[model samples]
Target chain A: MEYQRYNCGNCGACVAVCPQQILKLNENQVTKDPGCDECGNCTIVCPLGAFTWKVGHEV
Target chain B: MKYDVVVVGGRIGGSIASLYASKDDADVLMIEKRQEIGTPVQCAEGTTQSIFKILDMKPDKRYINAEIDGATIHAPDGRAIDLAEVSCENFLDGTGYKGYILDRKVFDKHLAIQAAKAGAEIMMKTTVKDLIRKDGRVCGVVAEHLGETMEIKADVVIAADGVESNMARQAGLTNPNKPGNIGSCAQYELFGLDIDPHQLNFYFGREIAPGGYLWMFPKGEDTVNVGLGVRSTKKTAYQYLNQFISRFKGTTPVELNIGGVPLSGPIDKTYTDGLLVVGDAAGHVDPVTGGGIHIAAFCGKTAGQVAAEAVKKENTSESVLKRYDEIWREKFGKNLEISLKYRNAADKLTDKDMNALAEFLEKNKIENLSKISAIKFLGKHPHLLMLIRDLL
Candidate 1:
């Protein structure tokens, strides 16, 4: 998995949309779990561009 | 007589701000224009489960009528999207949380109670006529209380005055909302109704309420809060709500809240020297959904904390209070900005496009719907999808 900088504002939109408990708010910002499988579940779910992929893909 | 902090408008943000300030060794006071807390409620009061964590209090069962797991979004063509239910706290703690349908009047009062318990003096039905300024900085508020115009002194003032935030405008922290950012919403608490109590229902139709959606929230076995929100561009919330209620074919209304949501983007600046703006007053509602409860609370708490910190430092400059805005922006600003872009995209969607989207969802699993796939689903209809793709 390639590394990316996601500014997750922690509104929990992604958490609200995530099927799995892979994302959460840490210190008022959103964070993904180490167990996250990168199913693009969060990237697809993010209303904002807060979630991103290792390789740039159409959101 | 003076105070360390004075919060104007005892709504969600104001109440929370007062509580935060008072709890931190500040002499805080909260003032409201209404005779009672949370009266003449304007909100649908549907809030995400994250509220508990935001307030750091367990909501008494009386305030929370039910815990909403999922929602049913029905399109104008009778197409529906069933958003899956996730654990409420998990949603906020991790990805996000479930929301609650509250009686805002009760909830707002509860918030004030928390503030009062924190040692903030609560004043009701008192209107702030203007800001008290000195050397080009705000020092307090000039308000009318019980037929007397009075000046209350404070080092800093927090404005949580809701949509028509004249206090902020008078202080020059924000301008009155432009027409585009306002949403007119109207709802009826209908008695004697039969509907799903668990699943919140949302309806979208071009003819029903253009530029907005209708909602049916079952309060209990026979009572429901049914309402519609239409963009001010299309019609007044009152006009759309009246038409929607007529189509209800349900029992008579027992109560009603006809109001507008300031879906406007957050003000460019939320603070001035000695003055801080919070809640709907600062136009902090979500751009797409026009929901402001959780965010209002979040910002209010932030404002309260920042004001308290400022008091500790003996500084109340716009620069100092600006920490509150920075915190709020760091937390929710970017997301709201992105949602506004989506709002632009959604507003341009035609009736045919909406109907097509509804039809597409009708044929698919409602549980799988989200922004990405929803866009993808809409993209399937070559013509409609192409239009959306190009626009997005």
Candidate 2:
């Protein structure tokens, strides 16, 4: 998954809603830990539409 | 780099603080993590006209979306009660009336611009990583700015960093929002809604929002901010928002926003040695209504003014910074206490209880309701008072 740095406000809204608890906000970007299940929760919870799945991968 | 004051966020509270601090001729710098000042907006953007008073200027046409005269509340049984006759006075100024739905992007940018014009330096895309402490006092911050890690020192640091504040924790202050204190929220900007453009609407029901309410605030002729907030529920706010959106036909949203609201009273302490926390970072939101813009504006200005004065006096100790806390608490503490009490009482109310309360208000010819009024009404009815006591 790729998150757009330009649109992210770093509000940590996505990190709060992530069920996997893999999302962490560092500096101004949200990063996912290796226990990676692409649940798409961060993509949906982001207020700024900043998160997007990598190309060729379905959310 | 060293400054008289360093504001950790460039949102409404931070911008206002910086503006006032700069007006006092203090060297101030505001840092924002986003590329744009107000990108990925988090507010419902509803505030009163008295914002003009705080800004000390007339209303700017660029940011005003709609002027609201009153509100209409919908009960769980679909009964609508108009509060047009109710006086919605400004909580601070106490003279002005009417609500406004703002274009937040423009409004926030305008505030930052005003601060800049007043001699405050604003740096976008700068994120504060941690506080630099010396002998238990926050002396500066370590931040990542423009791909470079740098240390910025300041006489005073203002943490207006929203609900997810790191400054408070770094300063050794406990997070004010406990498990049930924060309200999870989701909002959508929708068009093609058949809603009155001059009034706000609120829908309340446990089935809809367990411990919160749904709101429809008009932005323009055909656009509205449709949103919901709930606390401590098994379902996410997104699910509740989607379920609410399904009820309206022929409406599609153009934007989506999600965040958390501190529905608790102000934090136990907002001032630490050489540091002050304002806005949502300080939990300055009303517990019952989930409104914080006015509180933010009021407290932010006070914090800025006091900080500037303290710096001028060459003292940035917690004792000097404590004045900000005292002033704000004197102004808003009782009101917040009442709001929290009402929230506690309302949390225990069932759908039937809410319906009865609404009907009772209608029967009494009460058009406008406030926390004090609600308490008085409950006082008159022993059964309701008993219910509230049991819940508490």
The candidate maximizing TM-score is 2
Q: Model 1, residue B63: what's the lDDT? A: 84
lDDT (tens digit, per residue) of candidate 1 on B131-244: 889999999998877778899999999988776666677786665454445565667888866777777888887776666778888776667888877753334455566676
Give all candidates' CA lDDT scores. Answer: 0.73, 0.81
The alpha-carbon lDDT assigned to residue A21 of candidate 2 equals 53
Name the best candidate (by DockQ): 2
All predictions: root-mean-square deviation over Cα?
15.7, 5.4
Second chain alone, TM-score for each candidate: 0.91, 0.93
What docking tier does model 1 reach?
A: incorrect
Q: After superposition, how far is residue B256 of candidate 2 from its true place, in Å?
A: 0.4
How accurate is chain B of model 1, given as a TM-score from 0 to 1? 0.91
lDDT of 2 at B164: 67
Cα deviation at B10, candidate 2, in Å, is 0.6
Fraction of true contacts kept, per model?
0.00, 0.10
Taking all chains together, the TM-score of candidate 1 against the true structure is 0.80
DockQ of 2: 0.14
Query: Each model's TM-score?
Result: 0.80, 0.85
Candidate 1 achieves a global lDDT of: 0.73
**On residues B297-382, what C-alpha lDDT tens digit does candidate 2 reach at each position?**
88889889988998999999999999999999998888888888888888888898788777766655535556787777787676
